[model samples]
Target chain A: MATKKTIAIIGASGNMGSAIAKSLANAPYRILLFGKEEAKLKSLFKEIKNTNKKADAEIIGCAADASWEADIIIAAVPFAAEKDIAEKIRQVATGKIVISISNPLNETYTGLVTSSDTSSAEELQKLLPHSKVIKAFNTTFAGDFSQPVINGKTIDAFIAGNDEEALETVSDVVRSAGFNPIKAGALAVSRTLENMQSLLIQLSIKNNYNQVAGWKILHN
Target chain B: MATGILLFQSITVILYYNNMYEVLFENVSKKIGLTKEEEQLLQTFFIPKKLRKKQYLLQEGDVSKYLAFVEKGMLRSYTVDEKGIEHIAEFAFEGWWMGDQFSFLTGEPSKYNIDALEDSELLLLTKQAEDQMLEKIPKMERFFRLLLQNHLIAIQGRLASSLSNTAEEKYNQLVQACPTIPQRVPQHMLASYLGITPETLSRLRKNISLRK
Candidate 1:
């Protein structure tokens, strides 16, 4: 049998982190979970194992020993902690495909903390230049990750990255997790994607979108 | 002659009502599986209304009484700035819903003014009526929720465009998303919708044509 690919989800206790873990519970990959809170990571690991009885993939949880050898690293940390987490993982995550879902929304969320010209993904890329960074899942709510279909249509996950190879790998991961991955463009396009999340958040608060909604691209 | 006019009006009203029901039934059924009986039940809450061209469906100080759904023609919702310049927020056409949600929910004075761009047909449901319908038919709640979700997604896209895109890019995106918008809406209103001056829109159009 071929060796299973490893996907390391950092900050695995948070809402987004846990939701991604749930979506990948039965996937054909070794799920490596990392978090500051050991107890929470252990609990999530147990839940993933219980949910997927036919699970052949190794599910490992760690606090100090972060898995650097994983094929993919998901930065599921909050926006404030994005820099800190990236700095911590920079050396270990060198040359690996890193997926960022951070939205640099201001405290009020009426605006973005990061400049509209550059994105949170770009900022992270500057911090860790060696790692191939891709922006995705920022526009999707945790509620969307719960189910593949909303109103009988598959939710579209828009992704942007500079590296063609890295984006293709992430697209495969997105498909494995039951979403239609849409290649939006290069890494610079993350500005639009991140801004979209801020806008979606504001609309959700003002109009009661309630996080159950996501975007879908329909082709003619 | 007066009697004949009345008879014609009655038949037109009947046909309009049937069209309204058909649009609503299909829109709701596509989202949530609805039976014919449930669609009939859903039809009772809507009250049909007509607006002549330039007629105001809602004004700034009026507490919005109904969530208006468009069955025919176009309506524009906008707000006037302190300088009396209008900023168009949204345009609703066939099978679209438009209302001042804040005013409808809170009974407060609205900041928006909605006016018919053409002779328009509308179906209105008050908050109480909508609530009662949802209580009677729970599936309709899902339908409305999905509708709001779609609207939110579109609004988010517009917001993103405004924040990051240039005027020309915004115009291109708007046309790409709604191909008929530029054809149906007047250029001035299109400029307003894009948050640009009419002159800028004209220049952009000239530039685009020159490039072609």
Candidate 2:
């Protein structure tokens, strides 16, 4: 196992954020669950403790804002809170990769309401010019993400950001969760890559299908 | 016969921008860089249209026959779900393109209801004109391609933001980008565009005001 990086998820109480923390429990690292609802974080931390698999890293619970800088921060905030969170993260998160896992959909989750011209990630990048902001994990839903499928087929996940190293770090986290991370050029491509996933999901659901069913990356 | 001819011509050109040629030519020069002859030719192929407030430029289950340049006034593209709730997909102001791109490209009915936000004027293009341009104005093909590319890129970026940003952040950014959008569009409509309930939007605005 790779030496576990001390990773903290900012919005630990949310579905997506908690799913990430749970999935990575056995991966051998100190996991910090931070949230505004400290009681919720403590409760989840307590559940993971009951599992007896013995969390590999120091599993601590804290109640700091997810957007606030603290080591490696994985932001799983709601789309509306993303920019402010990024700004908050940038303030204290220095010289570290800050991962953004958000999907900017209209209120109905129907189609994109924002980026039809520019992206939330680009907006975040502008807001947090220094933080190595990477867009990942937002593509998959919490239902499917609770457990990364162990089936023979590897899932495709799009990863993009300005910093290659930060992108690599995110890839490791994805790989740790048992999915393939696709490197799609610079951060600009994040516009299409992230937004297209919304359409793909909507189409999949419209077709009475699961996004995970049609979701596959060609390895060739 | 003379009176009939004048009346017939009037219907064909009804409410069409009389200075359509001038306005579109100027836009083409700035945006797509059309030469004088190309500009004139492009102008001849297009017609001007005026949409009254809340009128349909395109509707759900209708084929998108025209791609319009907003010469003046505001428009919005939205879709109504089974519950008859209007979901605002996009807002087009002066000098923007608004159409059901899927319907426009595939010749299918759009799943959206696009309407004029206010009485508006547009420089319209038909599928026939686009195909004709693809053949006659080969150089112009690049312009349309670039337009689609940029639109695609913009849509993509929005998805990323949807995943990444919060409502307040997105709204603040929208205000910064357009500056006048919140004031121009109704609060509920703006809330719909933000993928939030009108209640949430109210609270968000209240929070921002408090901060100020």
**C-alpha lDDT score of every prediction, in listed order:** 0.80, 0.71
Chain B TM-score by candidate, in order shown? 0.89, 0.85
Q: State the lDDT of candidate 1 residue by residue for A1-220, as single tens digits.
A: 2224567788788888888877876787667777777777778777887888765334445421243436588888887898888755654454567899998888888878887689889988888776789998888888888776888999899999998878998998888888899999999999999888888888888889788777888889
lDDT of 1 by residue, B75-123 (tens): 9999999999999999998888999888999988888999899887777
The list of candidate 2 runs beyond 4 A from truth reads A1-3, A56-70, A210-214, B1-212
TM-score of chain A of 1: 0.92
Worst 10 residues of 2 chain B by lDDT: B12-21
Q: Best-fitting candidate, measured by lDDT?
A: 1
Give Cα distance to truth, residue A187, candidate 2, Å: 1.1
Worst 10 residues of 1 chain A by lDDT: A56-65
DockQ metric for all predictions: 0.01, 0.01
Interface RMSD of each: 30.7, 25.5
